[model samples]
Target: MNRISMVAVLIAGVMPFTVGCATKKYTREQAAPIINKTNELDDLTAKNSRDIKDTDRRAQSGIADAQAKATTADQHAVQAGQQADAANKNATQVNGQVASLAGTVENLDNYKPVAESSVHFGFDKADLTKKAKDALDQLGGQFSSTKHFIIEVEGSTDSTGDADYNYQLSKRRADAVIQYLADKYQIPAHKIYLIGLGKDKPVEKNATSEGRAKNRRVDVRLMTNTGDQQQNASANTPQGGK
Candidate 1:
């Protein structure tokens, strides 16, 4: 055989193996970018999941803070409402007291003494006898028919006890008479003035039994603004309570 033919045979034998190596290198080059891209995408997905978890935690914390503020506001509202109610009640009471004071002031100069009566009592007692009730019944009837009339009741006691004790006993006697007149005649309590003289203003001497009985008496004086006898009795006695 010639030398050229022998060289050609040697080249043919190695060509298939060289082509196979080149094909494998080309395929590996093409797949390298796809593998790197897949790794980058996996890392980005893990970071996104961590960020989403952090955002959820912050949102829950904000919700809890808002709920605490809402609870505080509700408690403050209840306290304010209760305080407002208390203030309103105080204002109403003050207004009523002012009105009553005004009414008393307006009627100061329009009344005068017109008539009087008396009821006697036993020693150291507040209960009324039959004679006392009969006297009060007579006065009550006359006063009921009159217009704008007020009664002043003065009570006294015999000088047999301490002054303080006598004073309180005298007051009890006056109150007993006042209550009877009010209940029996339906007279308003505002029109009556009550006073306790104790042993101070005695109409009789204190040494004798008859004089002490006269001292232990309740004197009731009726006064009126209506004036038929105003010119006849102009020096009307002043009514006072102590």
Candidate 2:
């Protein structure tokens, strides 16, 4: 209603507005660096989070690959061990077979014969006559119980034939005798020793037919040591060494 009171009211209202403006200005100025730093920190935090996720993913993949490689290595080692065991077993079997063969060879080396003789054959014939068979049978009977023995069959041919033909014929005769002994007596194959002398060592003259017939013959030699002969004589008594 008065002039002084109106003035005072106007100053009070204006003063409040001015103070509010100053306070807002001060707050804006003070908060400017803080806002900028907060924005930068947010960006760095986001980048660090992505980097951690990527590292975790890579680590998991590496672990998976390592486990797979280890499994494969274990399987391969098992297979190699099996192969080694098979090789060792095969080696043992082969060694056993070799030992058996060596034993057979030793038995052949220790063999001794009981009785032997010579028998004549016709020219160019590889067969044995009835008389020749009979003689061989008698010789074989001398060693009835013996399981191992050596029979050396030496074949000779007459001079009536060519040298080469006589040699071949002598070989055939020797082979025939060996085969007969093997088939009839069930003798082991390693026990017999056959040789063809052809006309090299003729027991009779080759000029006459009778002498030539005698030359074309097979001579069987019985192997014997002094001790073996003595034992054979004791067993055979009057029959002697046949």
Candidate 3:
């Protein structure tokens, strides 16, 4: 009776241990699948984060490029404004000179031509030659002893080009002569009366090349109010004869 009872107890204990080992193996298999799925989700989250950072960097780069372009455009606009202002200032100076000359012409009748000279130029040229400068030097030499005098600078061009173009060319020629006189002799601007007549006041016939060349010239005349002053002095003096 004691041997049969001991064998029964041994069989019951072995059966309970086998059931516990099977339950532990099933729990490990389920937990392994859940952990693999969680790892896959973490990898996906990391990839998404990298993509977001790259996109943000690209957006910032684009914004910076746009700002750089805007700054360049603003710089170009400022440069253009400065160039325009400079051109306007040059035009204003030319206009003022023309106005001053016009005012001097009003009292032209009081003056008489005392000395005169002609300066010739090449075809479509406004530059003064050596001969032209020498002629001007001779003309200006009289100014040292002269008093109450004014200079008349009359510019004319050949009838070769358009009327408008000829007018501008004549003006350029006159300016060249005036510049030389003012620079070398230090002649004041107020003492000079300037005009551009173009082909309208040509000194020679435009039929020949020589004549046309002669026509492209500037006539500078030194005039004085000395005669008017003398007449005024005589009129103001006491006279014995009526």
lDDT of each: 0.87, 0.81, 0.92
Instruction: Kindly report which residue stretches of model 1 are placed more than 4 angstroms away from their true locations once superposed.
Output: 1-110, 228-242
Give me the runs in candidate 3 sitting further than 4 Å from their true place: 1-105, 240-242
Candidates 1 and 2: which is better by lDDT?
Answer: 1
lDDT of 2 by residue, 22-94 (tens): 9999999999989999999999999999999999999999999999999999999999999999999988987
The weakest ten consecutive residues by lDDT in model 2 span 142-151
Encode model 3's per-residue lDDT on 1-242: one tens digit a residue.
69999999999989989999999999999999999999999999999999999999999999999999999999999999999999999889878877766755776798899999999999999999999999999998998778877899999999998999999999999999999999998888878878999999977899999999999999999998888889999999998976
Report RMSD (Å) for each prediction in the order shown.
Answer: 11.7, 12.8, 6.9
Which ranking of candidates, highest TM-score first?
3, 1, 2
lDDT of 1 by residue, 105-186 (tens): 4874666777778899988988999999999888887876688677889999999989999999999999999999999998
Candidate 1 colliding pairs, count? 0
Provide the lowest-lDDT 10-residue window in model 3: 98-107
Clashing pairs in 3: none
Best by TM-score: 3
TM-score, per-candidate, Cα-based: 0.53, 0.48, 0.57
In model 2, what are the clashing residue pairs, if there are any? none
